[model samples]
Target: MQRGFFVSGVASTMAENRLDNITHNLANVNSTGYKASRSSFKTVLADSHLAGNQKQTSSASYLSMGSQYIDTSAGSIRQTGNALDFAIVADGYFQVQQANGNIALTRAGNFSRDGEGNLITQSGFPVLDDGGSPITLPDGEVSGTNDGMIYVNNQPVVQLGLVTLINKNDIQQAAGTLITTPESNTESAVGTVVVEHGALESSNVNAVLAMTEMVATLRAYESTMKVVEQYNQLASQLNSDVGKIQG
Candidate 1:
């Protein structure tokens, strides 16, 4: 295969993936407690040998996506005036029980109650307390302190589960508002994990920046495509002129 074809293909692929990533972030700009992701990469050989050719050019190496990491920085907190909604003021995640009896971490605080008065997230997952158990609120007015302690009728009911990742990079953005939390990667809250009741955290995505980057990526992809077209044209000409000529 032509070296330009290989290079162009890899380049265009990188741009396409980058565009998809930016689009996802922009789509969730209004999502509560949503954290944006940024791409990182490293150079790697696309193919060591191709079409029985043993020698390859230095240009065969291309930039490959090494990994993606969330921004992790806290988003702006918006006051919802709803008692059940809460926002984390800093680095920590709220624990919610999934249908599989496993826990998923999230920063979204738009919580409500299930039929049994169990505190639940918007997706209907029961919220966990500090002791790693589902919290069931009694019938009464509920309130919370900055330290994550919940109260009903002036009596403490339970403390919310607020935890921090031992290494922030260990987690990944999962389906809709949930984060892939590894149990071993998490630890009890360290430092002051402030909680703001009656509010929710806004997504950290910057719409303007994302749109600008999308435009740039699209241009890059187009340029790479043009290069690939040129290579194809050259191949056709070679087949017509060189491959057909006989001495």
Candidate 2:
């Protein structure tokens, strides 16, 4: 394959990956406490030959991994009138107990109580209290405060676990979600996260921008495909012409 064709092929692939991420963010725009994700791109370095004496120069550009971006920007808080719904007031995450016994951090505040009276996200993951215990809300009208206290049956039953990231950049995003080794990084996890009841966070993704980028990426991909087809046709014609001359 021609070097130009190879470069265009890689660029198209990278653009498609970025488009996928943007599409996902737009799809989850209405999700409660959802955060928008961006894509990070890095240029691949050209191969280096043995240096003569002083220095070397780059030849061609390549595509590196397309990193999933985490938008730490705070979303707009909206009141939902449901006491179980909550929103973070600052830089922190509400820890939830995943099915695999691993803790996961999320901004999604739309929560509910199970038949066992356990406070959990809509996905059924149990929300954690300040002590890392499952919060159990009683059956009644509930009220919570930004200080991390939830009142049920006129008594404080659970305190939401609000924690902040010490090294926000150290967190890695994989499979369209953020994951970290919570035990390995102690110093990076410091201040407690804050929670406000009766409210939920909105996604920061701009739908208009996402849609525009998606359309542009699609067109670019099509153009690259056309180039590849032209190359193939030219190569085929050259072979046919050579055979005719020899015959």
Decoy 2 TM-score against native? 0.83
Highest-scoring model, lDDT: 1
On residues 75-181, what C-alpha lDDT tens digit does candidate 2 reach at each position? Answer: 88988889789888877777778788777777788888889889988888888887777887778878876777889767887778767776666665433333444
Can you give the TM-score per candidate against the true fold?
0.90, 0.83
What is the C-alpha local distance difference test score of each model?
0.87, 0.74
User: How far does residue 14 in candidate 2 sit from its true spot (Å)?
Assistant: 1.0
Residue 132 in model 1: lDDT? 95
Candidate that would win on TM-score: 1
In model 1, the worst 10-residue window by lDDT is 50-59
Q: Which stretches of candidate 1 lie over 4 Å from their true place?
A: 45-62
lDDT of candidate 2 at residue 72, scale 0 to 100 = 72
- Per-residue lDDT tens digits for candidate 1, residues 1-247, read 5666777887888888888889999999999999998888889875555357567544456787677788899889989888899999978999989899989999999999887899998888989998899999998998989988889998999999989998888887876789986799998772369999999999999999999999999999999889888889988998888866952
